[model samples]
Target chain A: MTPSTDSPPRIYTAALAIIGNEILSGRTQDANLNHLAKTLNGWGVEMREARVVPDIESEIVAAINALRARYDYVFTTGGIGPTHDDITADSIAKAFGLPLVEHPAAIALLEHYYPPGELTVVRRRMARVPEGADLIENPISKAPGFKIENVFVLAGVPSIMRAQLQGARAFIAGGRSVLSRTVSVLVGESKIAELLETAQGQFPDVDMGSYPFFKRNALGTALVLRGREEARLEAAYDVLVGALSAAGIEGHPGELPD
Target chain B: MTPSTDSPPRIYTAALAIIGNEILSGRTQDANLNHLAKTLNGWGVEMREARVVPDIESEIVAAINALRARYDYVFTTGGIGPTHDDITADSIAKAFGLPLVEHPAAIALLEHYYPPGELTVVRRRMARVPEGADLIENPISKAPGFKIENVFVLAGVPSIMRAQLQGARAFIAGGRSVLSRTVSVLVGESKIAELLETAQGQFPDVDMGSYPFFKRNALGTALVLRGREEARLEAAYDVLVGALSAAGIEGHPGELPD
Candidate 1:
């Protein structure tokens, strides 16, 4: 993949591919993407793309190939379970031309979780990992995750997936923390246009945004200010609060002031 | 754009671009893509791709150009609010070489929502919809959304965006509705291999999947069956339920068997 040429501190982008028919069917309100998005964004990595595909081998391979070449990292959720339809491991192996073998690290983790005497037939598949890949520790369940190239295959279940992500977070490179602050007001967003514009200019290095939430009950629109700069974030935040005060709209500094 | 050399199925495909800094900053968890995903799935149209881009003109345009050319439709959320940061209308117009103009239908809706002099600043900006685009009525805010080519641009907030989506649902064409059924069992997903294998063979056209979720701290798995054919869906669902029962795990109709 060609590297990004221009730079103003480029965002480290990743694409999330959620492979499950359940999420699309509305049976499982998938929270993995949202969780990953917030986590990656906080680390200053940009979640550029997200897609959900059914549990099809061809589909999975296609999506992995298509997305991995573009983004810095490609994370997949679902279909790593011990069930018959859990074909993500095989698909990843095929995509990377790697042999489907039990990695020593994964077998150890799986064995630690479910010993030979206590092992169920279904639990045996959890030990298999693609050859030449490192095991991604599953803090919640010992069914370890694995990586191939830029793709990190994970479980579909939110709880386990989040745990796997936490273990894998430190491995992600090119991340810088972006501190955020918010200033919400009852004043309509358009009423504070000049204030927001001034704030943006004042903090050119910081990426500033104004988000207006709906009026609570019969109050008014709440315009929340956000940016990366701490002092400027607070300063712009103060200016926004003062603008709301001038407009007779009461507000306070909060992450999400209602 | 060249049509897929392969056969075009009854299913419709779309890509979603969520243009918002609110979502990126973790200030607002985006519900638009998920809502649209479920809605589109119900309608039989597949949501192929989704991206959460900041309200930047070049980024928005590039995403729209890439996705619109690849998928059947592109739906963008956010950047249509009353705030100066709401750049969706202007961006969409610029993307398609369409001129930005005050849309009459939108102006009428905005005028009805606010008293004449109350929100002139807000309503005035909302009135500026691109020329040659149709209005997507907003029952919540009276700020009508716009549709250009295959791109449908809507609001960021869940409630208002949902309202606009209801108005625009009919406009989607050539997409297939996704039919899914589930059989939940008290047993974990690992034990359901034979049943899952049988379910897959019986329902070749339909995509069958198993999702295990913890309800009240109990380990239970849902054998979700999804397909386009009603008869296939019913047949597969029945097979799944029977397989579960035979495996000593109970399965019943109408959601998962408790």
Candidate 2:
């Protein structure tokens, strides 16, 4: 939602659509989601949701359409390669009801990257893009990713996708960045659930979470408080630490070392 | 859709709903999706889609409702702990339009696990589930997960979730297992796209995928063929290897050593 002229800054949101059968089939572990989430967070864009869909055209189209409608921006990874299973570009075109065509810039890039007479028909498939789309630079490889409206299509390879994301930084409009603080204690989550509930009630604006961890066979819980306002986050952290101390538990300032 | 009594076995499909803020915030990398996908696949259930949603109640309920309607079985992990941020139980109840009530078996489990007078009200929160739900056993910890209709709820921690999933095995009905074979060629995907395409056309029953990788500074692609019938999958693999050999590239039998 847009903010009023005198209101506070509006928070930007994004969603990721991972289009690959390898991920859904357990053949390949997805490495792009965490990197994308952290990168977007640093730019003040919150990644609100993500979906891993197979290479099926209908599934990819539906996921792209659903995410683009709800989030400020939608990004998709995978299905843009030259192989037969790489159907991301065509699926995205279908999702937007547009025709797929060869982009002149993409073709020129591919032609220049490959040796003379080596850019075969199948290799040139990477030059195809949805009509009326802008190309996102791929530094690692000659083939470029494309952007159409609110959806940004990226490669599935982690290194190439990270490079294209950097090129996409110019297109994203960021808002106020959310900051967080963490406190860890050598106690299980259930041991401090009531205190955490009370602290959460006291600071309703700050989003709090408790994650249980096992360190050297000792059970512990990490309490994290996140908010856009630094002052509010600090206050909440202090209150949480004070409550833990009152209950005769030592709350470390940060997460325990592994 | 069900198969005829005399027809071949039907392939069962499942969808996962991962509920957590840590995953979306980039604080935690998800470790459950791949494990669940592999486990379900081994049991002859294909993981068709997965969604990572925040801990918001509305989002959780919406994701659950959407996934459950489309897949044969739906699984959810995270947000079932005792902390205030844990709201999966309530959201699931809302999704099914059922009342949230304390399960007697769950209470007994928790009471038996914790020390005397330690199972406080907040600790007892884990015992609450949707009305008319069956309990899923937790081997590591005493807090039990629950199953309501087609949806199975598990914990966020990897070890605990894996244990709970083993307990859920009895409730699932599996189909024919999908088998796969991989051949790695020391060439980029673009170099062999046409050959792979032709091979895929020859064996339409097998699901083919090409994944490019860079190992030891050498570019290569892994060609994978999957199908329910072992003979068909092997034939596809043979065709792929033959195509690569005709193209003057050696095809390794399996994935490249890491």
Q: Per-prediction RMSD in angstroms?
A: 5.3, 2.6
Docking class of 1: acceptable
Candidate 2: deviation at residue B195, Å? 1.2
- Most accurate candidate by DockQ: 2
Scanning candidate 2 chain A in windows of ten residues, the lowest lDDT window is A1-10
Model 1 over residues A1-258: C-alpha lDDT tens digits? 223243546558888888876655556666787788788877677776676776778888888888899899999999888888888888888888788987777666666766467566567677676788778877776667877778888888778888888778767885555666655556566767666666677666556566666545543454554444466667766766676677676775554434
Which regions of candidate 1 deviate over 4 angstroms?
A1-13, A41-48, A57-59, A62-67, A94-97, A115-124, A173-175, A243-249, A255-258, B1-9, B41-44, B117-123, B173-176, B254-258
Error of 1 at A45 (Å): 3.9
How far does residue B235 in candidate 2 sit from its true spot (Å)?
Answer: 1.2
Query: Considering only chain A, what is the TM-score of each predicted structure?
Result: 0.81, 0.96
Residue pairs in candidate 2 whose N, alpha carbon or C atoms collide under 3 angstroms: none
Candidate 2 lDDT, B2-100, residue by residue in tens = 333457787899999999999999999998999999999999999999999999999999999999999999999999988999999999999999999
State in Å the error of residue A228, model 2.
0.8
